[model samples]
Target: MSYVGWMIFGVVLLVIEILTPTFFFLWFSIAAFLSGILAMFGLNLGWQVSVFAVASTLLVIFTRPIAKKIMGEAPRKVYVEELKNGVATVVQDIDSSKGTGIVKISGENWRALSVDPKKVIKKGEEVVIERIEGTTVYVRPIETEAKKEGEEI
Candidate 1:
C-alpha cells in the first residue's frame, strides 16, 4: 500500500475509534499510523503489512491491560438512588447553622446536612437519608422518619 493509503486507513480507523470507543480500534489506528510512517520511508509492501500486524498485536497485548487497570471500576461511585431513603450514622453533629457535618452511609463517610434547615442533629444519631446532592447527604432524624412510616402503615 502507498503512504497515502496507509494514512487514510489510519484516519478512518481513528474515526471508527471515536465513534465506538470500545478500545478495539485504538490499536489498529496506531498500527496503521506507524505503517503509514514506514511506507513514507519506502518500506516494502509486505513489510508494511507485517509491521502493522506486529505493532497492533504488541499494543493490544501490552497497553490494553494498563488501560483497563487505570480505568478499572474499583469501588465505583454511589448514585443518589443507592442512598436515598437509606440509613446513616451521624459521625459529626449536623448543625445547619454551620452548614456542615459528616455521616457514614453504606460504610462510606460523606458530608451531611439536615433536610430541614433549622434542624440540628447531634453526633452518634442515626439518620435517614433524604437525598444526596454532590457529596452531601441531606438527612432527617431516624426516629421521626420511623414514626412517619409507622403512621402511614
Candidate 2:
C-alpha cells in the first residue's frame, strides 16, 4: 500500500486504541505509523510489512509493562466475605417472599435478605451481616437492650 494508506490505517488503529484502551492496539498503531514513514522513503510492500511486524513486537515487549505500571492495576474485586459481621442499615424493607431489600454498608449499597425470611426487616433499622450468597447479603437484626429484655419477658 502507499504511504497515505499506511498513515490512514495508523490513524484508524489509534482511534480504536482510544475507544477501547487495552494497550494492545496502541503498539500496532505505532508500528503502522512507522511503516508509513518507511513507505514515504520508497520502501517496497515486503519491507514495509516486515518493519511493521518487527516494530509492533518490539514495542509490545519493551513498552507494554511500563505502560501498565504507569496506568496502575485494574480495580480490585470486593468480596462479600470481607463484609461479614459488618453493620449495615436497611435502605429498603426486606421481605424474602417479595424478594425486595437494599442495605447500605460502608458507603456502598447492596441487595439484602433477612436471615429469618419470615421476619420483615424494616428500612432504617440496623442489621448484622450473617452471610452472603452470591450478590445478596443475609442479615439479622441488631439486638438492642430493649429487645433482649422484651425477649426475656
Candidate 3:
C-alpha cells in the first residue's frame, strides 16, 4: 500500500482503539503510522510491512504494561470490613431458601443473603451487612426504632 493508504489505515486503527479501548490496537496504530513514515521515504513494500510488524510487536511487548499501569487498576473493590455494619437497601426480595437477593449499598448493587436462611428480607427493607463471603454479603434486617421502643416497654 502507498504511504497515504498506510496513514489512513493507521487512522482507522486509532479510531478502533478509541472505540473499544482494550489497549491492544493503539500499538498497531502507532506501528502503522511508523510504516507510513517509512513508505513516505520511498521504502519498498517488504520494508514497510517488516517495520510495521516489528514496531507493533515491540511496542506491545515493551509499552503496553507501562500504559496499563499508568492508567491504574480497574475500580477497586469495596473492602469487606468497610462494608460490615453498613446499612443497605434491599433491591430484591432476599429469600435465603431460594438463594437469591440483591441490595444497593454505596451506590453499587450486590448479591445478598440473609444471615438466617429461614428469614426473608423483603424489597425496600433496610439491612445491615454482617459479613461477606466471596461476592455475597450476609445480612440481617435493621431493627426499627419503633420495634426497639416496643421491646423496651
Tens-digit lDDT track of model 1 for 1-153? 999999999999999989973677989999999999999999999999999999999999999988777766556777779788999999999988898799998888999999898999999999999888888889999777677899999
Give the whole-model CA lDDT for all candidates, comma-separated: 0.90, 0.94, 0.96
User: What CA RMSD would you report for each candidate?
Assistant: 10.7, 5.2, 5.0
Of models 1 and 3, which has the larger lDDT?
A: 3
Which parts of model 1 have CA positions greater than 4 angstroms off?
Answer: 1-61, 64-73, 144-153
Pairs of residues at least 3 apart in sequence or in different chains that clash in candidate 2: none
**Candidate 3: tens digits of C-alpha lDDT, residues 62-146:** 9989999988887887787999999999999999999999999999999999999999999999999999999999999999999
lDDT of 2 at 153: 100
Pitting candidate 1 against candidate 3, the one with the higher TM-score is 3
Q: What lDDT, from 0 to 1, does candidate 1 have?
A: 0.90
Candidate number of the best lDDT: 3
What TM-score does prediction 1 earn? 0.49
Candidate 2 Cα outliers beyond 4 Å, as residue runs = 1-63, 73-76, 149-153
Q: Which residue pairs come into collision in candidate 3?
A: none
